[model samples]
Target chain A: MTTSLKKFRCAALSVVKHDYVARGMAAHPRFELVVVADDPGVPDWIHQRNQKFADEFKIPYVRDVERALKEFHVDVAIVSPEAERHVDLSVRSAKLGLHVVQDKPLTPSRAEADRLLSEIEKSGVRFMMWNRNGLPAVQHAQAEVAAGRIGRPRSVHIDFYFAKDAGPPRGARKTDEQQCGWLEHQIAAHVDGSDGGLGSKPMGELMIEGIYPLAYLRMLTGAEVRRVYAQTASAFHQLYVDHQVDDLAAVSLELDGGLTATIAVGRIGAASHPSGGEIKLHLLGDAGALVIAEGKPDVGVYYRGQPERESRQRRIAAENDFILADNFAQAIDSGGPTMLDARASHAIFCTVEAALESSRTGKAVTVRTF
Target chain B: MTSFFVHTADEAPWRDAARRLHQSRLVAAAGEAHAEVFDGALLTKPPAIRAALEAGRHVLVAAEPCLPRVELDSLQRAAKQRSLLFALFNPDRFLASRQLLRKQIDGPLGSLELLRSHRWENHIAPAPLGLSGSLVGEIEQAAWFYGRPVRSVFAMQPAGLNAVQVQLCFGPGMATIDYCDALQGTTLTGYRSLSLIGSRGSAQVDDHTNTQLAYVGGDGPTGLTVGEGVRHLAAMLDDFASAIAEQRDFSSTVTDALHTLDVVAALQKSLKTHEPVTLEPAEAVR
Candidate 1:
C-alpha cells in the first residue's frame, strides 16, 4: 500500500509574519503544502502577501478560511498571523478537524488561549506550538538528563538575549514627542524582519520571546513553574518606553521537586554581541553542572566584507524545523502528544503572564495552572 | 618594617590567608606585631577585635557572615578612638584576573553597562551563612566594580531552597549575582563565573571555560586547574601591607564593609517580603 502524504495549508501570510514554519514542515516528505488560506476580513495587504506565498509554493490561494479548509481537505493548518488572531484561527481550524501548528506568544489574551485549547481537546486534534526545543543543543541537554549524567536537576539558569536593534535608542526622542503607534512601528519593523510580536498590541520582549525559553525549562525539568519573582526595565528602546512595556526582564522561578531557576531576557542591541545573541543554559544537578550555549555547534566565519551583524552562520542549521516537523508527524502517526501541546503552551503563556504581574506588583506571583 | 600579628586559629578555614601573611616580605608576620588580622571565625568574638583596636593595633577582619550594623559601628568607633586603620578583607578584588578587569573597566571597556557573577559551591556551612550571607563578598565586588552606591536591590530565594538570586542597579550599570550551594558532592569544589559587559567590549571569567582538563584514562576528563583561588591571598596581603605603610585607606574600608552588610540585610528582607528594596542614598564615607 502506498503511504499517503498529509496535505497542509499555510493558513496565513507567509510574506508578512513568518514562513519558516511552513517551509520546515514542507521539508518533511510526509507533509505537503496544498493551499494558502486566510479570512476574507483581513486587510488587502495580507491577502496580497498570502497570494504571493501561494504563488511561491505553486498552490491555490483562498480568501475564505472555512471554504479553503472544506475544499482542500487539508490535514494540517499552520497559522502565523497577528498575535491576537492566533487563537481564533487555530480554533477555527481545529473545529474543522484539522491539526494546527500555531506561532509563538500563543495569544495575548488568556480567554482566547483557553478557547482554542478547549476546541483542540474537544475535537481530539493535535496542536504544536513552534518552539526552539528541537535544536540540537537542547536535545543534547535533554539526553544528558535522561541518561542521568548530571543526576537529578537542582537548579537551572537561562540567559536568552536577542541582540537586535529596535529602532531609535531610549532617550533619543524629545520630551514632548508623541509615542509611536504600535501597529505602524511593528509594520515598519517588518522591513528589517525584527517584528517578533506582529500586531497592533504592543507586547514586550517577555511576551514575544518568553515562550521559547520557558518551554525549554518545561521540557528539560518536566516541572511546571510554581511561582515567579520578576523585574522589568525599558532600557534599550524608546519604543518600549513609549508603550510602557518591558524590553528587558529577569525572572526567578520556583518549580516542583525543589527546582530553582532564573531567566534573564532582553533585546539588548546588536553591538552587545557578535552573533545574533547569547542563549545559554546553566543547569546544576545532584552530581555536577552543565553549561550549554544554545548558539554553539556552529562554525565561525570571517572575511573582509562580512556584515558586522552576521558574525557566524549556524551549523547543522534549520534542523530544528525538520526535527519539530518530524516529531509532529510521528505524534500524528503514533497517536501521541505533539512536541509542544496546547496545554503546555498555555502553561508557558500563564508563566509569562505571572512574570509580567510580578514585575508590575514588585512581588512574587503564583503561576496559574491552565 | 611594620608587622601584623596573624590571630587565626590553626584550623581556621582561611589557612591560605594566614600562610600568605606569613610568607609576605613587605610586612613581617610576628607575635609582637603592632597590627592584627582576624579570621572570619573570630567575628563571633567581637571583643577580640575590640581588644586589638584598644591596644592601638590596626585590624583587618574578613568580610564574611557579615556583622550587624551596630557591631560594625562599635568596631569602627574603637578603631577611631585608637586612631588605627580598620579594614575589611575582600580577597576577590586581589585576584589577578579581577585586577585586570578593574583596570580594563576604565582602560578599554569604557563605562560599564552590565556585570553578572555566578558562584556555586558544595561545602558552605549552614545557618549564619545562609544564602544572603554567602553573597556578601560578591555584592562588595559588584559595588567595587561600579564605584557607586546601589540605587535599588531585588532578590529572590524560594522557601527551603539553598540559593539566592539578586539584582543590583548602580546608576547606569546593573549587576546580577546568583549564589547556589545546593549541589551534592563528596569533595569540596566551587565554581564561579564573572562577566562584565561594557560599552566598548565584554569579558568573562568562567571557570568552566578556564578549566584545563586532561583525558588520560577515566570516565571523563580530570580537571587539572580551575582558575585562581588561594594564590590571590598573597596579593591581598601585599596590598594590606602597602595600605598600612603608606597610611592610605585599604581597598575596602569599614564603611564599605558596612555597606555590603546592609545590602545583604536588605536582600534577606526582600527574600522574605517578595518586594524589591529601594535603597536611600548612602552617606559619604571617609
Candidate 2:
C-alpha cells in the first residue's frame, strides 16, 4: 500500500543544508518543501495556512503550541534545533501531535532522556530520528548473507568512515548539524576512527559507523551478543585535529556467538594517516566465510566458497539517502518502525560508549542499561 | 562454580577494611570462606581474564593494599566478562585471628554486582590501612567512566609494594599538548619513575626520587607540561581516593610525587639552559 495523496508540508533550517551529500532529502517527494530560512520563525500554522496545502515559514520565537495549531495548521512539526535543544522540540512536537523526524543522539544526558521519551510515547505521535540511509553495500551484504551466500557466522569485523560529516549522526538525517565531540555533544555525529581523540572515535568507529554493517550481521545471524570484553587506546592523541575532534580509533569487540571483531578507524588529524571512509565487514560462519568492504569511496569483497578466486566490483549509483528518507516517511505515513530507530541507535550508542570507556580506562566497561 | 584464589586467613582484619568499602557485605562476608592462604597466589596466572570468561568462572582478588595500581584496575575490567574477576579491601569481621571481610564488597564502577552475578564468590576487604582514597576514587572513576566491572581486594591489611615509584603512573600518560616531545618518555616507560625494569635492568640506584625525574634539572615536561600536569593531577586523585577509604597514610606517595615534580621542573630549565645535564647529580635524595 503506497501513500498516494499523503501531502505533508515540511519546513527545516539551514543546518539541513551542507550536512549530507543528498542534503535536501526531507523536502523531496511526498512532503512539499515549504519553510526554510536563517531562523525558523514560529507562525501559528492553523491561523496562517489560508489554504490546506499552502507552505509557510515562521520565526521560531513567535510560534507557540497554540499558535502552531491555530495559525500554521501543519499536520506535524519538525524541530531541528541545536545540539542541546533537540529534546525540548521533540517533546513539544509530540505534545502538538506532530510526527517528528528529529536527528540523532537525541539527548546528551540520560536524566532528561526518559522525560522526553516518555512524553513522546504518551503523545502517540510517530516520533523518529533521522538515522536511516543504510550504506548501499551494507544492504547488499545483508541480502547476500541472508540468501546463504556465506557459510556459518563465526566472527564479524567492520569499518566505516568519511569526512567527519560522511555518515549522518548515528543513522538519521536532519537539517541540524551540530558540532561533534566534547563527550557531551550528543547530536555531534562524526564517525570517529582510531584517530578520534579518545572516547569519541570508539563509538563513531565501531558502533555508529559499524552499526550499519553489524546490524546486517545481526540480521544475517539470529544470534544475540551475550558477553563483551573490549580494549581501546588513545594512541592518536598526539596529532592535532582540525575538525575539533579526533581522527583515528580502533576497537576490538567480541560478540556472544564466539565472534571477535577487530575494527580499525581513522579521521583527519595533523599527523593522521591518509585513509578515507572504509568499512571491512567480515562474517565468519562454520561452512565458509565472506568479507564485504563497502566499495565507496571503494567497494570490494572476498568470498571463500566454490570458486578458486573470490572478488567483485560494484559502482555506487548516487547515495541511497532517498531510500532512507522515503522509508522513514512511509514508516510514519504507515505506523511501522523505521529500520533505524531509537532502540537500535541506543544499542549502538551504548556499545560504542562502552568501547570508548573500556579503551580509555584499560578495562572492559559494563554497560548498565536495561 | 568458577574457582578463585583469595587470601582468607582467620586472622585477617575485617572491621577496619569495612570503613573504606561503601558496600555493607564486609562484616557479614566471613562465613563465605573462599580459600585459605594455603590456597597460593591470590590470582592464578592462566585462563587469562578472557579464558576464564569463556569457561564461565571469575578472577577474584583479595590482596594487600600495596598491590600495583595497574593490576587492580585491570582486574576490575576483567570482571566485566561472564566470569567474576574483581577485588577490594574488606572489613575484617570477628577477631583478627580468623580473617574475613566485615561488610559489603566494592566493585570497579560501584558495587560488586557485576562480579557477584558472575560468581567471583570471594570476599576481599580490609586491606592495608594506607591505601589512598584517590586509588579508590580513580579506580571508581575509571570504573564508572569506562563502565568496567570491578570489586574490592579483600584482605586483612596493606601488602608491601607501596613505596612511591609505582605512584608515578598515578599521573596521565604522556599526551600533553605542550610537553609534546617530553611526553614521549612517560610511554617509553610505563611511568617516568617506573624505570626499574628488573633487579638488573640498569643503575643499582633505587628509591622513588632517583628514578623519577624529580630532580633540579629534570623539569619542563614533567614540571608543568600538560601531560605531566595531567599525570600529576592523576596522582592528586590518589590523595582523594585514599582519604575516602581511610586506608592509606597519605604522605609517601603524595610527598614523593611532589618532590619528583622537580623532575619536570628542572627539565624545563635544561630546555632554557640549552645544555643537557643530570637534574640533581642523583646524590641528594638518596
Candidate 3:
C-alpha cells in the first residue's frame, strides 16, 4: 500500500511580513503558499517587506483578506497580525472554511479569544497557535516525567530575562489611528497616561513576550494553572513614559495536582550572548529534577580589539521557526495534535490576564476555565 | 592550647569531620585516649555533654543536635557564659570551592541579583535536629554570602519532609534552597550545585565528581581548582582554634545557629499560612 501527500494550499495574512513562516510553508512537502495578504493600514515600509517576501516565496500578494479568500482556494490561513487583530482575521478565515495558524496572545482579552475559539469550533477547522519553544528538549522532559524519571512533579520555576532593545522595533512615525490600536489603547485604558510618552507598541511585555515561557511551562509539566498571584512594574524602559505596561513581571501560579510554578520575566540588561536573553527552567519532582537553559547560541566568536568584539552565539540545530511551521503542516495533514491548540492558547492568555488582574488588585486571581 | 571534647555517636554524619579536626592539630583531644570519640559513644549521652560543659572544654557536636529547644538553649547560654566554643560542623562551608565562591562573590561578581543552592542527599532521613536542621548549613551559607540575615522566608513542601523548596529574601538579593532525598545510591554529579548570579558576573560551583568553580564576566570562563582532598573540617577547626586562642568571634557561632532555627521556624509557619513570613532584626537575634 502507498500513501499520498495531502496538499495544503496556504495563505499568510500579516501586517508585517512573517517571511520565516512564508518561507517555511513554501518549503514544506505538502504545503503550497498560494497568497500573501498584507493589511493596507500598515506602513509602506511594511508593505515593501511584504512584497519582497511574496516575491521571494514566488506567491501572489493580495492587499486584503477578502481578496485573498476570493482569489485563491486557501486550505489554511497563517495569520500573524498585531495581538488585537488576531481574532478578527482568524474568525474571518475560519468562517471561510480555512484552517488557522495564528500567532501568540491569541487575542488581547478573553472575550475576543472566546469568540475566535467559538468560530473555529463551529467551522470545524484545524486551529494551531505558533509556540516555537515547544522544542524537543521540553517534550523529552515531559516524557521523562511521564515515564516516572522525575516521579510526580512537585514544583516548577522558570526565569526569563531579555534585553530592552530585544523588543520589537517601534517604527519611525506614530499616527493618531495607530494610537487607538491594542497596544496604545491598553495603556490609556488600564494605566494613567500623565507623561504622554508613547505607549508600549505591542501591548504589555508580559502579553507579548511572556506567552512563550508560560506555554513552555504548560507543555513541559502538563499542569493547568488554577490560580495566579502576580506583581508587575514599569521599572525600566524610560522611553515609554506614558504607558504603565509592565516591563517586569513576576507571577506565581498554583497548578493542578498541588504543583506550584513561578515565572519571572523582565526586559533588562543585554545578555553576553547574541540571543539577547536568557531562559532557565527548573522542574523539581520526587525522584529527580530537570534543568533547562535555553537562549544560548551554539557557537560564539570572541575577539580582542580597542573596545572588544563578539558575535552572539548561534544554534547549530535547525531553527525553531522551521520546526513550528512543519508541526503545523504535519498536524493538518495527519489530523493529529499540534504542539499547541486553541484551548492551550486560551489557557495561556487567561493565565496572563489573571496575572494582570492580580497585579492590579494585589491578590491572587482564579483562572477562568472555559 | 584550647582543649577539645568531641561528641559523636555511631553512624553520626559529622564523625569524620570531628576526626579531621583532631587530626589537623587544631585542638588537643582531652577524653579517653581519644578512643571514646573514635568509637562514637560519648556524644549520644547528655551526661557527657554536661560534664564537658562543666569542665570548660570546647565541645564539638559531631551530629545534628537531637536535644530539645530548652536544652539546646541552655547549652548555648552556658557555652557563651563560659567562653567555651560550641560549633556545629557543616563541612560544605569549609570546602575550597566555598572559599573561592566567597572570593568570586566579594571580588568579581558585583551586586548579587540571585543565588540558588541545591543539595540532594541519597537517603530520606528524618529531621532529628529539627525540620530545618538539615538545611541550616545551606541557610548559613546564604547568610555568609549575602552578608545579611534572611529577612523573609516562603517555603513549599509538597511531599512534607521528603522535599522542601524554600525562597529566602535577604537584604541585598534573593535565594532559593531546594532539598530532596528521593534519589538513592550514587549517581553522576551527586546533584550538588550552587549558582550565584550578579550584575557584573555569574559563577556556578558543581561539587559532584569534580569540584570546580566556573565563573563568567569580569574575566570570562575562569575555572578555578577547588583543591582535591582539601579538608573543610580542618579549615573550620583552624577557625575555631584561632577564635578561641585570640578570644574573638568564630566563623559560625551559636547565634548563627539560632538565626537559622528562627528562619526555619518562620518558614514552617509560612508553609501553613501560605504567606511569606517576615523576620524582624530583634526577633532574629533573639
Best by TM-score: 1
Top candidate on lDDT is: 1
lDDT string, candidate 1, A259-308, tens digits = 78888788877776788777878887777677787876888788888887
Clashing pairs in 1: none
Across B187-262, the per-residue lDDT of candidate 2 in tens digits comes to 2321111111110011111112223343455444332211221222222222233333453332232222222333
TM-score of chain B of each: 0.86, 0.22, 0.74
Model 1 chain A worst lDDT window (10 residues)? A6-15
Off by over 4 Å in 2: A1-3, A13-18, A21-24, A36-71, A75-80, A112-117, A163-247, A254-262, A268-275, A297-315, B1-286
Q: Residues A1-370, candidate 2, lDDT per residue (tens digit)? A: 4456577654443232123311435445766444432223522332232122223322332333445443555554554434345567666667777666655544444544555667766776665555424666666666767776545555454444332332222223233745344333332322232222122222333433444443554555544443233332222222222132223344444455444443444432221112233344544444434446465434544456634222243345534667666766777777787665554444555555665565466443555442
Tens digits of per-residue lDDT, candidate 1, B1-286, equal 5566665554233455546665343234534776787655434457877877787888877545366678778888777677688887666777888888888886577666678788876665433434444577788888888877776777765334466778886756777787877555424467788877665456678876787878988677776546676666666666677777788855346767777766777787787776678777874322
TM-score of chain A of each: 0.96, 0.65, 0.83
lDDT score, candidate 2, position B113: 14
DockQ of each: 0.34, 0.01, 0.15
User: Each model's TM-score, in the order given?
Assistant: 0.88, 0.42, 0.75
Q: Poorest 10 consecutive residues of model 3 chain B by lDDT?
A: B33-42
